[model samples]
Target: MFTRMNGIVCLTMALLLGCVASIATADEALDKAFEALKTYKWGQDRATLGAIDAAVVASHKDDAAKKDLEAKLVAVLKSDAPQAAKDFVCRKLSLIGSAASVPALAALLPDEKLSHMGRYALERMPCDEAVAAMRDGMGKVKGLVKVGVINSLGVRRDAASTAALVGLLEDSDPQIAGAAAAALGAIGSPDAAKALGAYQAKAPKELKLAAADAYLACAERLLADGKANEAKMIYMTLAKPDQPKHVRLAATRGLLAAAGQK
Candidate 1:
């Protein structure tokens, strides 16, 4: 019995040592990858990043490793690394990043070259901080950068951005206005529905049809959420003869669905 117990103890110690050695090897690999990342460029050998990618995959079930990887990625974002390196890091962060990564990612939102990658990470963060970062980014960016942030906010279904988005509906740039309308529709809140309804009359000729479609989208979401009366109100408005035949047809279908009909 003494010999058997001694053997079991030896096996346990061997397993522990093996795990420790594996962890040490992974750490060394990550160190080498990060060193290579500093000078990484678009057409460079991607094998340099393979270690980091492997670390990310291994992090899935290991929260400590995930957080460690995220911290390292965030550090890279704060560095002066090439855009290719930053872009790769942001992509990895999108998968395992937590709120801790919010500030670093947010800092890149106004950078024309990096904004989209930053948003790519923030969009999947699933935290209020990420949403706030995008919202704050809206005021600092312009043109297409601003549009990307607006789109990310909508993708998040952030009702908090509805008021800001409503204001954007009147932006002088039709693309901005159109994107805001679509985002509000994607949000599909009561406030979004109301705002879209009011915008219909004032919508520029170029945007009139887009606004109507957004309103329809809002109504569809409302109906799905058990807000049938509100949905019906929007459908009835779009069903008016003055609206286009296609809009009317969609509204008619919405009306039927709202009424719980087959």
Candidate 2:
């Protein structure tokens, strides 16, 4: 059984992949769509939402228009536009473009254009190549780059990266550790839960919070598998106020949720 996040992540990739097809051309429609993107601030404005949607839909039917739009999007990604525009392009790639744009998007990751947004774009890529790139690049990078890989793997639900994620839970950098713990929580696997639990005693506040979330999630699955005692202890720890506020809050809610479960 997939978790809610896992289902949404898979559905996102599937939907993006499914949307890849040739677009037809019509000057009025293409112009309207581009205007929508510009006016809506790249889909952030509710008023221009319809126009943005129209543009994306129109692009699917116009090959020349689609290529032109993708080029524009990439340029938007590269341009000195407001941070909001760059962010919107990076975050909405899957929503408006095909997998073919993935290579171009991936190329942006190293451009020093916007490090954080580049990571966001890479995470949104609709292909396994993105995961491979993150994994292969992990050892060569540190700090935010490593954090990006942790996030991308979680969003992808790439279980194969679980061991690497677990290893990062103890990384010298607390942010990296925290990201690893959060990724594990998002992955929500029993193995990840156990890995998090094993480090709970020494993890920092943020890492502890993340570990607690993962532990509670994992405990739920374990409880579902008849590991009652094990699950109870994790819930018990989480419910204690002595824990970090986030951890305590998560644990208390987890306990309540677990109690009502059959």
Candidate 3:
């Protein structure tokens, strides 16, 4: 998934790209940007893409501008581009993708070489359809691919996956179980917190630390959202001496924070 830092870099690059595109014709600008996506070169082709990226974002609010860019992107996906070339487009889509891009992005989910980046785009695409696509994908893939899907859903904070994630807490693969635990924490809902709490004794010893961390995260979110009492329950549980010293400290601090809520 793109981090805040990546978003910052993309925005900065887009601004510079905006300046570059102003000097080029419409056809010249897009062709140059498409070429840059294939180069995957930094400091060099990034300038071309930066201009293209800026154009996409600036046009998002205007239906015609958005559709034009979206069409160009779809054309790139439909082309027989190399995996590297396609991957480059996926990164751009993550920044400005909508439901229109879902089918193209969704196609990459089952591909071993591309599933990671595929999820990367789908995770950031702000639409109910994007969420549904990933959620549906969870059952169709397995092992690490499924793990990737789980992680993306977590990053998305898809509360709808709470039950599915809770079910995954029982998987024999420790990593899968651990990922599920961490994802539940990312969700940080009252029910998610309860599930994490319930999974405590059943989760492997290797999984407890993640559970603890997630517990704290869920509690903190609940506290912040005016659900202090619910948050306090988690805080009290983790504040127990049996929890690791650091977790106990965090729980204590959370308790104090919760006390100040309305």
Candidate 4:
């Protein structure tokens, strides 16, 4: 009886060892897949990243495993990899669209190589950290970086950042100024209307479109502020034939909506 029992116990131990080895092999395969994706070769890298993402989605049932994989992904983003690779990682984090990556992504704003990518990623992020980063970067940054900052702040719809965006309406760069005006319109802040009027004065015909849209935004805010008549006037001015095509479109729609109320 003792000899038979010893043989059975040894067989069970061997089976357990085999199972453990198989699991280790699978983990190694996953790690290798992640590394291959780090090359960013497009076809192979995209495929590998897809696999990793699917694995992450499937492993949610095991909290510890999910956390471990996410930690690894964060490390990959922080690694000294090629910009292409880092870009892929940044886009992937944006795809995950969880607020968890906000802090990490915000930290990359000052990295010259990653600034544009970081801003693009932040546009998709739309969290407090992302808003704060865009607001803080606006004054000190310039050129395309500043343009990106404006775009990000606008997309986030941070009401508190409206003042900063309004300030950019006077920016020397036409693109920056125009985008800021558009953002103000998108935000629809009542306080932004006066600033937008200043923007309209200096804006060219093309830039006027942005200003016209912003006027509509200001009009909406006025309506909410119990100034429906003032909103109606601005809306009518926007719809004039002399206005740019885009401005006329915004104005016509606003006037139609207000007229319907009568």
Q: Candidate 3 on 1-262: residue-level lDDT in tens?
A: 9999999999999988997786566658767777766545434545667656777778866988777777778667767776776777788788878899888888888888889988878998889999899988887877888888989998999899999999999999887788888889899898999998898767778888888988888887788778999999999999999889999999999999898787
Query: Which residue runs does candidate 2 get wrong by more than 4 Å?
Result: 1-57, 60-92, 110-112, 125-127, 217-233, 236-256
Please write out the lDDT profile of model 1 over residues 55-135, one tens digit for every residue. Answer: 999888899989888988999899999999999999999999899999999999989999999999999988899999899
Q: Residue 216, candidate 2: how far off, in angstroms?
A: 3.1
* Strongest candidate by TM-score: 1
User: What TM-score fits each model?
Assistant: 0.92, 0.59, 0.79, 0.75
Q: Any runs in candidate 1 off by more than 4 Å, and if so which?
A: 1-20
lDDT of 2 at 81: 58
List model 2 lDDT by residue over 4-33, tens digit each.
Answer: 999999999887766652223344555665
Could you give candidate 4's per-residue lDDT for residues 25-136 as a string of tens digits?
7787778768876666544446656656666666757767666665666677777766777777677666453455666666677677787777777777655776776677
Cα miss at 150, model 4 (Å)? 1.2
Off by over 4 Å in 3: 1-24, 28-60
As a TM-score, model 4 comes out at 0.75
**Residue runs of model 4 more than 4 Å from their true location after superposition:** 1-26, 37-45, 59-67, 97-100, 110-113, 204-206, 217-230, 240-242, 245-253
In candidate 4, which residue pairs get closer than 3 Å at backbone N, Cα or C atoms, i.e. clash?
none
